[model samples]
Target: MLDPSVAAVRRAVRVALSRVAEGGTALVALSGGADSLALAAATAFEARKRGIRVASVTVDHGLQTGSAAVAARAADQARALGIDDAEVVRVEVTGAGGPEAAARDARYAALRAAAAARGAAAVLLGHTLDDQAETVLLGLARGAGGTSLAGMPPSRDDGGVAWARPLLGVRRAVTHAACAAQGLEPWHDPHNAEDRFSRVRVRERVLPVLEAELGPGIAEALARTAEQLREDAEAFAEMIDETIEDIVEPAEAGIAVSVAALAANPVALRHRVIRYVVDSEFGVALTRAQTLEVARLVTDWSGQGPIDLPGCTAARRGALIVFTARA
Candidate 1:
């Protein structure tokens, strides 16, 4: 019988690559780790059957002492797996949102750029179910609300290139087992063992505790919650789009929404509409407090003066609530 881990990962790669334009190249963002290496191996094995070209790109975030060397070794593994055009790209990580967030942003941007340069239809990521659960948990810790809890999509389009996480349905242990079954040695990142990063702490301490106390399957449950939230969020997004068109209009420097229209809707929709308009117009994300204060102009009108926000100002101009860019 075929190994269950191998079968599971291969099926995931096949299904993920199926969405990409056939007869085109698919790039795997290999990090020399089990998750990405297993993904690369599966893609290499499946691409030929699908008539799709496969390659791998190892990103050197230049954080660790020997990151470049690790990336080179990963590229070598990709080449050994029948991918001839394996390449390593190095990036400088800034501490903009701390080390982890900065590194992720740089790595994904580099992957998308590589895809566009090569005309690759899709870039496959190595995020597993554990990653999704951790992400949802982090969002919850930050009080990031429902949208943040929705977690990562299976696939998304950014900068005209498609990005996919074929392994989100797969477990971290499964990827490691798949690599072992293939006689492949996977590089373990030392950061994963450290408690400095919140993610590492979650993986090591929090999740283990949750699994022990909750009797396992907590990660799967979190992943399932994220999936359901994503579906519901998509529906809410469509409703917001449909409602925004009729009630919102361009204002002096930003946008305006009908106060009467906003007040007429449920409180849930009203806050969403307010935040959506500001985000789209001025690129500012309003906190729940900020959004609620803005909503007050509609629900509790009493000749209140203009309210200051992150990148814009909200004021009641008769029947309309105007959001103007702050000078």
Candidate 2:
């Protein structure tokens, strides 16, 4: 018999699975952590009961010395949980960034590829409330806009694969409890305890201080803040879309936004509108300063001049400000 907590997780997974399109398979990304292991176990149990098949994939990011062994262990656990098709994917991390970030990028890329191979309708991840809270805090520290402060979404589209986080509402402790109840021994990643990682620093040092000074429910509060910010960001994006429809015009070079129309909207909406225009035309996200500079070109510039942005270029063309990639 499944314990009450395990039953609750199963219920959550069932609800998440039910929301997937009909006749589509679900792929669970098993990392062997307590949260992801519990997610796989609950998802497998619920999927079998519903007569739906579930596939598991573990990404072996060759970073730590024991990563391959950990990935193998995760695959073994998935098979033990009755997952028929368990596969371990090997991916190499490259580029100039933090090792954790590079590994995450490679891992997600591998998962998307595996999902495509498995014909999965969506990829399920195990991002718990604590992870969400930590993300919110990290974004806050960066002092970015509301969108940055908004943590991971419960469901989002990535490379044509719907990514869903069924465990977002669950606490990490609850997942650990579920693992214990199921007699599963989850592997603990040493990197999580290393203070060198920014996320771990926030999770261990900063969050504890906040909880001590503010209250015990600080994490929950931050998670709630992220949820609220996400809603607000969505609505703001919708407004930006509407503004774009009203103000955007096509030019010989690229898309143009009417300076007069842009100036009519409030500053916040105007900044977002510029970002929307740049991203839609060039497939790039602009920094706050870049967006502001583009807005200035539209509102304050007197003549035509080029403004360079990452993977894009914005210029004031007569009464319209155009954004496009440099040739």
Candidate 3:
């Protein structure tokens, strides 16, 4: 009999695998961690059942000693678990946005390259519910808007490959249980236990404390919040797309929005309109403070000078709020 945790993970992977074309490989990003190992196991089973090939890629960030060994072992485990095509790609992590963000960017690039080389139809990630909850908490802590708090999407298309996170509904503990149920030994990264990383602290300390004080299921609540926010963001996107076409006009090295149209809309839509205009024309996102300042050009109607934002500046020119490129 399959363990319940394993079965749950398998079910999720089956849905993800359904997106892959028949005769094409579905590449699993295996790190030998419990989440990824369980993912690889499930992909192997489910892909085979659907007459699809399963492959695995283990990324070595080269951060710690014996990292290559870890990567090699992960690939070996992939082969042992009925994944005949297993490979390891080593990446140099540039500490650009600190270490975590840089490593993730490099890892994903490496995985995309590997998947393309392997002719895989899509790449599978193992980010689970706990990860989503932590992401939302971090976004909220940073005072990010709805889209940031929306957390990770279940699937996204990058360049050409479709990236899917099938385990977004699965809990971290369940991945561990799934690996154990399948007699798979998982590698525990020491970085995960380190207190220095914000995510590690959230996982080890913040979330546990929250759960204890607020009762259990706080993680689930956070994940749900992210899902709901994502839905709201999607709707806002549709509205913005429909609305931007009418109220915006091309200006001198910039874009202009009708101040009358913006001020007449509801506050929520007004704010979104300002943001969407700046984002579309300038290729930059406005902070809430900046957005509010931009809105003042419409609502307050004071004769103010140009308000500088990231990569652009906003100014009130009669009935138009013009956003122009920063000199």
Candidate 4:
């Protein structure tokens, strides 16, 4: 009999791989952790049945001691799982936004490069339902609004590379169980226990407390909330695309939106249009307050001076709200 945990993971991987072309390659991001290791093994099994080539990439951020050795062991595990081509890519983690953010940026860049080099149809990630719950909870705590609360999408395309997360519906414990069932030893990263990282705090402290006090299904409930919000976001995105074409036009430096058009929609759609326009034009996100201030130009037309944004400025000029790049 197939282990139920293994079956659950394999089923998820099989469904995610359906979009990949037969005989094309898929790359799994293997960190040697239970979640990623289980994903790698399942991908190897499922992709073989579908005539899809499978490989694994273990990113070494070199943050912890002996990180290279850990990456090498992960690669070896990938090979043992019948993944023929396993590569370890060492990345220089440097940038703003602290160590965790920097490491993540470097790791993603390496994964994208690996996928591009191999012309892989998809890159598989191991973020599970628990991760989704943690993300939503963090977003809520930060008051980051709907976009952050929407959590991670199951699939997205970045620079022509398809990134897929199949286990977003599976629990984290299931991955650990799957690894044990298959005699796979997952490397437990020490960073996971350290509460210095916000995610670690959420995982180690916040979630357990919520589960104990709020009952046993807090994580599942949060995951479901994320799924629903993501659905609404998709619908709004389509609406923004349609509405933006009719109301937005080129300005002197950035872009201009129709004031009357902005005023015509409900507050929800209006705020979305305001945010979508600025983001699409200037490549910067606006806060809810910033967005409201922008919307006020249409709602409370008081001939106010230009509102300064991160990379641009917004002001009303007759029928149009003009957004211009800051010099």
Q: Locate the minimum summed-lDDT window of 10 residues in model 1.
A: 154-163
Clashing pairs in 1: none
Model 4 C-alpha lDDT versus the unseen true structure: 0.94
TM-score of each: 0.97, 0.94, 0.95, 0.99
Candidate 1 runs further than 4 Å off: none
List, residue by residue over 131-179, the lDDT tens digit for candidate 2. Answer: 9999998888887789988899999987777899998888898999999
User: Which prediction has more favorable lDDT, 1 or 4?
Assistant: 4
- Arrange candidates, best lDDT first: 4, 3, 1, 2
Instruction: Give, for candidate 4, the lowest lDDT window spanning 10 residues.
Output: 236-245
lDDT of each: 0.91, 0.87, 0.92, 0.94
> Clash totals for all models, in order?
0, 0, 0, 0
Q: Which candidate is the best by TM-score?
A: 4
Q: Rank the candidates by TM-score, best first.
A: 4, 1, 3, 2
User: Which has the better lDDT: candidate 3, or candidate 4?
Assistant: 4
TM-score attained by model 3: 0.95
Evaluation by TM-score, superior candidate among 1 and 3:
1
lDDT by residue for model 4 over 1-327, one digit each (tens)?
999999999999999999999989999999999999999999999998999999899999999999999999999999998998999999999999899899999999999999999999999999999999999989999899787899999999987778999999999999999999999999999999888889999998999999999899999999999989999999988988877889989989889999899999989999998988889889989999999999999999887999999999999999999999999
